[model samples]
Target chain A: MSITVRIPTVLRSATGGAATISATGSTIGEILAQLASDHPGVQPQLFNEDGTLHKFLNVYVNDDDVRYLGGLQAPVADGDEVTLLPAVAGGFA
Target chain B: MLTLTSEQRDAMVAHCIRNLPNEGCGLLVGSDDGVISQVVPSANVADSARVYEIEPKVLLRTFRAADDSGEVVAGCFHSHTHSDAYPSPTDIAQAPDPSWHYVLVSLRVTPPVLRSYRIVDGDVTEETVTIR
Candidate 1:
């Protein structure tokens, strides 16, 4: 299955400034792994040393957050859109 | 410089006030020239007085809208209920987009204060905000 991954501005450097790219996978995890393989710079940004999704990065497959959709194991169909947005969070702490 | 209409600036301040006790957050949609065309207020899903997270759904919709409209998601704004209009340490650490204009609104005083900055590689540099 081919999926479209929308890269956020922060991660553009990893994709050579491309805002969106296409990768093939049947699951979110596989697609992300393919992305990391294609763009080594994105591996550290998307995953932690233990291979878990970065806590602050939000990944959505077709408008629904993957965290609520079985995380990276979430199934995806061909043409599914994946979006990566870093958590826009901060405070006066 | 970040250019906003007077109404857009006021809308941001009003949204922050409405979400009192918790930080208010929103996305800025604009053209490539840094002139904001829309001030999209969103629920601070974090729901904390000390922190904020723009609702993910809102963000997705905004990105789609901007793409459809040939605009861009320029940046975002958040209100600081107790501190000055500056990016806190946590803000610096969580700065998501280096190209984005991080706008902070300080409500520590009676009248809110708004400031814009470009946070690149953990460095914060204030930018001029022109309200027309």
Candidate 2:
């Protein structure tokens, strides 16, 4: 299955400034692995040494969060769009 | 420069003020050029005086409204209850769209201060806020 991954601004450097990229994978985990292989610079930002998605990174398949859709094991199909967003917190000092 | 109408600016300020000790957050809707046409006051689901989380239901509704109105989600707006109108490190790290404007309102001073910024690759650059 072909999936399009929307790259967030913070991780764009890894993709050579590309806003989106397409890769082949049957599941979200496979797609991410292929993406990391294609752009090694993003591996550290997307996953930890334990090979799991970083705590602050939130992945969404279309409009549904992957965490609610079986996470890495979530099945992916052709023309699926995945977005990565970082969890942000800021307010009063 | 980011352009905002006086009424929209005032409404945003009022929303922040109404939130009191808690930080207020909302979405800025407009076209791709940073001309904000609407201020979508969203609920701060974080419920903490020091943090703000946009309510998901409200967010969905806001996006739908923007779509129905032929506007794009251009930026984010939030208030700092007791801090400067600047983006914190967390904000920088979480900035998802390089093309988006980050509008901040600070209620720390007698008159609330408002600022706009573009955060790209961990860099924060302040932009001019043109009130029309």
Candidate 3:
């Protein structure tokens, strides 16, 4: 299945400054794996040494967080759009 | 540049001040060009003077309201109880959208200082704020 992956600005360098890219996979995990293979620079930013998604990054499929939809195992199909967001820590005293 | 009306600016400051010792958080809604149409104040679940978390339910409701009004989530605003009106390291790391205008309100001064910023790829750049 083909889908659109929205790359956050922090990871745009890996995609040669392209804000969005197309990938093919039956599941979210597979699509991410393909992205990593295509843009090696983004692999470290998205995945940990243990291959798990970084805790700080939040993935959403069509606006709904993936954490609520089975995480990396979430299913995907043609035309699906995935967005990545990083958790912020501010308001420090 | 981000434009905010005087009332809008005051609303933000009031929300932050009302929270007092606890940090306040909210989302800004408007056009993508940095025109703030609304300041949707939200609950700070963190309940800490040094931290904040926008209540999810409030966020969802605000988002829906903005959607219905044809406004986008232009950016976010939060208060720094004792720090300067600037984007902290954690704010830089968590900026999800490069297009957003991150507004920081510091209550440390007698007259709270408000600042606007844009965070892209961990780079923090101050934006012009026009309060009319």
Candidate 4:
């Protein structure tokens, strides 16, 4: 199946400044691996030493959260959209 | 005294009340399966405090805690103590994330109205808010 992954603004720099990109995979993990392969610098930013999703990162399959669904093993059909959103820590005056 | 397990919800209301003078804000996470444990806050940003802004760092920390415990961004919430429990133009203009709900706890005293909404792309859709 094919899915599109959206990279939030904070991590855009690792993706050559691309906000959205596409890949093909059956599960969230596979799709992420493809994403990092497409954008070499994003792996370190997204995964930890053990290759698990960072504790501060959240991914949504369509409108549902993957953690609630199945975490990295969450399955995705063609045309699904993966939104990788990290916590925003900047303070507004 | 007979009581049910409404302590959390009640505490949320109380938190809103106590933080009423500074636009108190916070996030909620947890609940397996159906996506519950949402976030809400009552604003203390009175008419004169419009110039101030929420601390994103605080929100980020809450989000991190939620993520660590396997929670979605679920929703973002803030209070409308000075006005109705609805998204204002400024709220839309300043909305940073597009995937969460913006719960509003209006503390107008005369009549308290607590509401929830999904503000995405500048559009606000009211969600069902049951005080349970």
Name the candidate that leads on lDDT: 1
Clashes in model 3: which pairs? none
lDDT of 2 by residue, B38-84 (tens): 88898787787787776655555565577688887788888888889
Docking class of 3: acceptable
Residues B1-132 of candidate 1: C-alpha lDDT, one tens digit per residue: 999999999999999999999999999999877899999999999998999999988988998899999999999999999999999999999988887889999999989999999999999999999987
lDDT by residue for model 1 (A1-93), tens: 689999988789889999999999888899999999999999988999999998889899998999999988999899899999888788866
Q: What's model 3's overall lDDT?
A: 0.82
Per-residue lDDT over B3-118 for candidate 3, one digit per residue giving the tens place of the 0 to 100 score? 99999999999999999889888889999799998898988877898877776555555655776888877888999988899887777766767888999999999899999998
Q: Which stretches of candidate 4 lie over 4 Å from their true place?
A: A1-93, B1-6, B31-34, B38-48
RMSD of candidate 3 to true structure, Å: 4.0
Every model's DockQ, to 2 decimals? 0.84, 0.30, 0.28, 0.05
Error of 3 at A15 (Å): 2.5
Across B75-111, the per-residue lDDT of candidate 4 in tens digits comes to: 5445556767777776765555655555565776554
Least accurate 10 contiguous residues by lDDT in model 4 chain B: B42-51
lDDT of 4 at B80: 58
Best-first order by TM-score: 1, 2, 3, 4
Candidate whose DockQ is highest: 1
The positional error of residue B54 in candidate 4, measured at the CA in angstroms, is 4.0
Docking quality category of candidate 4 according to DockQ thresholds: incorrect
- For candidate 2, what is the DockQ? 0.30
Which ranking of candidates, highest DockQ first? Answer: 1, 2, 3, 4
